[model samples]
Target: MSTFFFSSSKAPSSVSSFPSFSTHSSSSPIHTFSESMMEGRIENAKPIITKWNLNSSSYTKAISVFGHNRKEAKELLKSVKDLFQAMHFLVSENSPSHKLVLAQTLMQIAMERLEHEFYQILSKHCDQLNPKSVSGQSSDESRNSDNKEASEDEDELKRAGKTITEEENVSQLAMSDLKAIAECMISSGYGKECIKIYKLIRKSIVDEGLHQLRIEQFKASRIQKMNWEVLEYMIKNWLSAVKIAVKTLFSGEKVLCDHVLSASDTIRESCFSHITEEGAMNLFRFPEFIAKGKKSQEKIFRQMELYEALTDLWPEIELIFNYDSTSAIKLQALSSQQKLGDSIQTILYEFESRIRKDLSKTPTIGGGIHPLTESAMCFICSLGDHSEILSEIFAEHPPRNSTITETNIGSSTSNHSSASPASVHLAWLIFVLLCKLDRKAEPCRKDLSLSYLFLANNLNFIIEKVRTSHLKDLFGEEWMSMHNKKLKQYALNYETVAWTKVFSSLPEKSSSPIPPDAAKECFRRFHAAFEEAYMKQTSWNVPDGKLRDELKISIAKKLVPAYREFFDTYIMMVNGDRNLEVLVRFGPAGLENYLSDLFLGTHILLSSSSSLSCSSSLGCIIR
Candidate 1:
């Protein structure tokens, strides 16, 4: 009784015949009912889909359903694949869909699965069917049996009634669906799967000739919808992946390294795609990752490793060098200094290297971004600020003259002061003063002469004779071109101004218990240079207009009074901490009187800077 009821329930309707069902008899009841009935159902639906032109729309709906629920999507997608396979059977039977619905179905399923094997299979089959490949095969197989087999295979290939190009169009649509699904997987927290899918997408990119497809997708739509949660995950993990890949490269995991490197290159290209030159340089300048809990030494070591890797990235290094030489110096400084005195040693080495070797193989331009001239200048500025401490550091690590050979030539020369730390310090100061004046092109009628002379006497050469054109030539042009510039072209126009600022900023009083001998030398030379340069550079210049002359006279007349004011200020500032030993060592007998004159000179320069553009007034102020 139960069997009869089951048979009745399974029976097809016999009411006005819309379609007829074929029953397959199998030894296994389950296979007959389940596989055959389902397979037959797909076979029957294919023609209906073709007749009704619903293949495209139905497949789209299936995709949407699959996205909402993977299990349901998989089931629906599997059914679609089966349906297409059934259509292949119909094509073999010499009956095919008008739109080749089975072929379209297969294309959709292949796209949905995004299986590499499936792509490989389709590609292989497509290659065989290509006009070029088939042409020769067709000519060789002319027998009736061969003809029938060819006809059947051709029919299966054409089940969609579309040409190879049309089939490819359908396949491309499927490929797009695969991309969408991969993105969905990533969004749904299936990152490993997403990465796998991405790999497949990349392969498809090559196979399908779609360049930057993933990047375009990321830019076009996906990134905008991303919340902080998604963003944080990507940011924190993306570089870890890159680091992991880089680590593999060192560990001999060649294949893994290759894949990671490829991925990293892609990611870097995408990231920098929208960055400006400044922004990119700034990005590299900032330390991206530092090892946690490392002390200074270890931190320095780790940073050196990263710096080496970065420098090896020639393109990035070049960009950094072009964009910010200061940043490059800082990085290079850090790189060279993992060990003791490494930065200074490297600099000395570079200077020696340049002297010893012809630099034909080197880059045409260097130091433009980070010249030794600037670095040396920075040392002077540091001393100018905290001379009491910088003086100590200077003494310990005296500025080195790396020309071991040059020293022997001048060995007997009592100008050993030039090799002294004080001398080197003064040289750097002079260089910096000249550079500042040249760069700013500002007038300096101030108390700069004293400081300039202090540097000049100890530094072995006054401005013109310093072999390196780093400072002298730089300022010389400005001195000559001053007439062409905004200020009156005093021979020492900018040079004077730069020196004034330098002198004003230099340490007048010692922070330590007592001042070093260097400080006294600095003070004495400062005064002499001040008086001479001012009297010489300004006094003999061309005549000024009457108004400028009156201004200069007013300046000169007030110089005595201004000197009084400056002397009083200086006495007060130094009196609080003056060391009698240092004062006496640095002295003209009457410091009070000397201070007054210095201030008077400074006042004249400061005032005349506004009027007498020539050196005549300046010469008097200094004198």
Candidate 2:
């Protein structure tokens, strides 16, 4: 059996005017139909809806009729002026399964309609607020021309039956609709979708006005019930954006250092502007914000976290300041230590300038020290820690005798007390480092003559550099005096150790040389000793002329007298001056000249055999 129901209205000519109809077949039970019966049933249902009444029997009948026929159900729903009216009616009377089906259908339709409306509005606003168009077309003529061009383009697009490109059709969403959609998605647990909607609308949103309104609201709410979560979210997002921007700007095959620095400056300005203006009161009331009745301490820590984030770029800055092989190449003309020192100085100066500039802008409220200052100080102070290397270079070639004996050497010590702690500390470090260098080179000193001479040269160079540079103010007269004492001691040790053998060959007292064998042996020893000393000491260099002369005089004093006594006793034994040729290997004047040439780094010139006669009995006469 089949039955039909109709409302109390004229039926369309396309349909039969029957108020109710029924069909019965052999396989079906008998069915009855009447206009009055249908009208009565509808009338009974009318009161249920009109009075906002509901019953299980009425709901069952409605679902049985409409649930099977979606087309009729939709038509009935469309006849209502308000969609919610039908929804309310259905929700109150429909079965749970029917309600679920109805809700899903409604939501699907709503989403489709909302999406169409959203895009339509977005396209309209986007065209009107086109930043590129606005920027490009300044005058009215240009604007009209652009509008005409756009119209022509649109007509051409329509003729071609092609949609506009996404690049040409940028979106600018209506905030109200955007917010509504976001709210709907949030309520439905579509958090990611809500965020997407907000992101799309962000460009169209009036940032300045919205920011002002939000700040005002935040301030008001904070006074009554603070929302630390919201504040923290805001701060974190801002810091994260800054970090991302910096990393993006600085990261590439060819990093733009100037751009990175400019971006850093911009971030610094923006952050401080917010804190000094919008966030000042809140920051000042940090204690209150973290109090029991207020927000968490995390709220107060946000600014500090931002500070740490900003200053954390120290590692990158350190890299910039680093003296790498590239820098060494640039400064290759400079000596090794000079290259290192210059690099350090350049980094220190740049870092100091940047740090001071940055810290100057930072608010010192609550006695907070800017991390920039602390970081810069640590970096500069660290340079002094390389004193070991500096000392080695400085002491590599000490001053000659002229430099150490300068009349002004003692006058400079008074100024050392006024030296800055940094300079003084560095100087002290250099001193210790030089001492260490000397110790490391001590193994070479086992060859007393050569090594002591090397020490003397190095010590002299060190003293000269200190006296000439700022080091003089750090290492005073006492330091100079001590090193000078070492220099003299080295000179003395060379003479003592090297000449012991020569001196040992001579007897303490001269015995009469009546024995020809003893005389011949003594002369042989004398000639060998004198010649060897002259040859060896000539090759060894002592840069100071005066020091060389002094050393020569000292050697002559020891050797001249002993040789004269031996010669006087030996010459009387040999006849016809045959012994004279043997006894005098070098004249006294020649010996003095040889002594003078001890550190000249030149070959000694010997007189002819005939000129080898002793001018003084104790003097050298070399063959």
Which candidate number would show the highest lDDT if scored against the true structure?
2
- CA lDDT scores, all candidates in order: 0.33, 0.41
* Model 1 misplaced stretches (Cα beyond 4 Å): 1-41, 44-73, 87-596, 599-623
Lowest summed lDDT window (length 10), candidate 2? 10-19
Task: Give lDDT tens digits, candidate 2, residues 1-623.
Answer: 01111111211111121112233353432124233333333333332233211122444323322224423322322322123333333333332434334433333333322333333344345323333322222223221231122245345445433443444332211222232333332233232322333234322332332343332223333544646666566555545543433343212101211111122333222322222222222221222222223322223234334434434543542333233322332122123223323333333334434433442332222112224323433332343343333333234323111222223333233244443434433443334334443453455555666656665655565565566655654556766787788778977877887798788776667343346767667667767787787777776666656566777788889887777677656654442345565455664455666677677666664444643434455433444
What lDDT is reached at residue 271 by model 2?
25
Instruction: Supply candidate 1's per-residue lDDT for 571.
Output: 36
Clash count per candidate? 15, 14
Native-to-model Cα distance after best TM-score fit, residue 392 in candidate 2, in Å:
23
Q: Candidate 1: lDDT of 221?
A: 39
* Residue-level lDDT for 131 in candidate 2: 30
lDDT of 1 by residue, 1-623 (tens): 22321132331111121122233234534333343444565655444333222133545322334234434434433444455444334444344344344444533333333332223323333322222212222211311112122234335447533644664534433332333333332222232333443344233423232121111112313433555455445434433432332232111122211222232333322222222223222333323323211123213323334434443453433332332323453354233323222333234334334433422222112101113334444433332333333333345445554322222222212134434443344444443434433332222223343233222222222222332443332223432232222222332332444345325423444455324444444444545554454444343221223323432443345333443334333432343334433332222223223323322222223122221111433221111
